[model samples]
Target: MIKSKWTSEQLAWKIRRHGVEMTHLSGGSHLGAILSVADIIATLYTNVLNYDVKNPKWEGRDRFILSKGHAGASIYAALAECGFFDVEELKTHYQNGSRLSGHVSHHLPGVDFSTGSLGHGLSVAVGFAYALKKDGRKERSFVVLGDGECDEGSVWEAALFANHFRLNNLCAIVDHNHMQSLDFNENTLEIENFGEKWKTFGWNVIEIDGNNHQELKVAFKRVEEYTKDENHKPTIIIANTIKGFGIPFMENDILWHYRFPHDGWEYDCAVTALHQIKPEGVEDRYTPNSIENPVLPTEKDDINNDHTFSHTWNTTYPEQMRRVDAKSGTNEKVHNV
Candidate 1:
């Protein structure tokens, strides 16, 4: 088990590091947008979504679709941190025959679906959520779309369908970094009032700083509560984020979106700056289990000491049975089951 909860700052550092590494390895761009969404992606995987690393295909697991596939580097970093795959494999990103392409690939273990083309993820999420609701399942579907991608008419069509179906289990997070491929969002194509647009489309909207973990958690909690009520409208979280959120020189710089870091000084400076920020702990929130097991055990024996003998016995018994079953069968079945 991961002993520490990843702070937004720590996550940003990792994302920046990974982005630099990926660009050096793959000679690609999109680092700025990738960095911008890193905190929200980290928050969803670490604190919000209910997913099992051992069971990536679990039916009850939440679904996360990355609509802006260009931001694949950040998602890859988050997945590696979450134990989906070996972090070293990130070096293969965008290389010939590597599954970690410039865009997200469904072939990846933790990726719920493949996406690269703009304006497609929300529709897929809407379909997934509608099906889950029809089957009376509790799984939630989340889609992250780029603000620039909103220009695609399909996105609005999907929004209309989501509202018509009243799929409250669906949540769409728009990465409003304000820059598209060529120029500023407003200068290229204006989406001046995104919040009102979503609201007008019949979605419950919550606008917040996407980089703030506490705020993201609160927004998601509200979404959860809204889903529980009889009211069944879809929810949209307009996470106002900055492009290249962590790198001092890259923040809000349009060049970073398309320019790959080539010089060692630029890369080193970004990494050094990112490491300067310390992890900020979540505030005013307490979980009974978290309190009971603060500072997670670094070893197996420590786990036994943290809890009573009876509790350890109860917990270890089922785990032992699971391990035995896992050893007795094919690895594929073990993973999928």
Candidate 2:
């Protein structure tokens, strides 16, 4: 039986370790970005999301879209931990002819949408929420966007449309890490007054330490409650995070964004850093029911196998909360949960 109170730190460590393992095997980049957002993904899967591993197509399940699709490795780790797929399959990530790619795909069992292009997921989430509203369904949609991706004009367009319709069921989290593709976001494109910008666009904005599991849980609860009220405004969480969050040398280094760890020493350092942190526990407020033995995918063909991914809904509470860690800029201490 999965425990009710699992540590977020543990999840983050698992994500980092898994990401490193995948990178070592696949020789791919973006490990730093993926590690940075592990906690945010972990919190959502563990504490807030409503879905079943057995029935991935359940209509009542909440939806999560990773707008920053390059972080697919981290998301996949979380999904596997949440019982969406077999963890062993992660070794095939980015492998030739493998379902797991660098970007998220709709073909993945627990993935809600295929996303690689920036500025696309928020709009897709908005559309999903609008349709749910039209059908009188109580489902909610969650999206995580990269800070650098905010430069895209379509993100603002989606914000306008979401606000215009008062799609309160829609929630978006911006990973406010300062770095972008080529340079620091401040140097590349100045986005002064980020909070005010979202508020002006008609969103209920909440800023929190993205690495803190407690704060994340509180923020998620607030968003849920906010959606229940008559207020027709959508919510935006400006999650303050660090680029290259876990590995000391990689933190805030632009080179790490696209660089894979090459030296054995760097790999060893990453492993040690992960070992020092512990996972956060789930809160006592929500109790989980026992989970039955999961049934494995019968045949590879039964798997969606598309490059696209989507999530189905489940109404019952599961045994464990899905947990992952977000990156904190500092290296003084490892914060989990």
lDDT: which candidate is best?
1
Candidate 2, lDDT over the whole model: 0.77
Candidate 2: tens digits of C-alpha lDDT, residues 236-331: 999988877876656776666776755354555555555445344421111122112323334442222211111222344443442334465433
Whole-model lDDT for model 1 versus the true structure? 0.78
Off by over 4 Å in 1: 1-5, 278-337
Which residue pairs clash in candidate 1? none
Clashes of 2: 32
**How well does candidate 2 score on lDDT at residue 298?**
43
List model 1 lDDT by residue over 244-302, tens digit each. 88777678777778777664455555555555563444221111122222232234421
Worst 10 residues of 2 by lDDT: 282-291
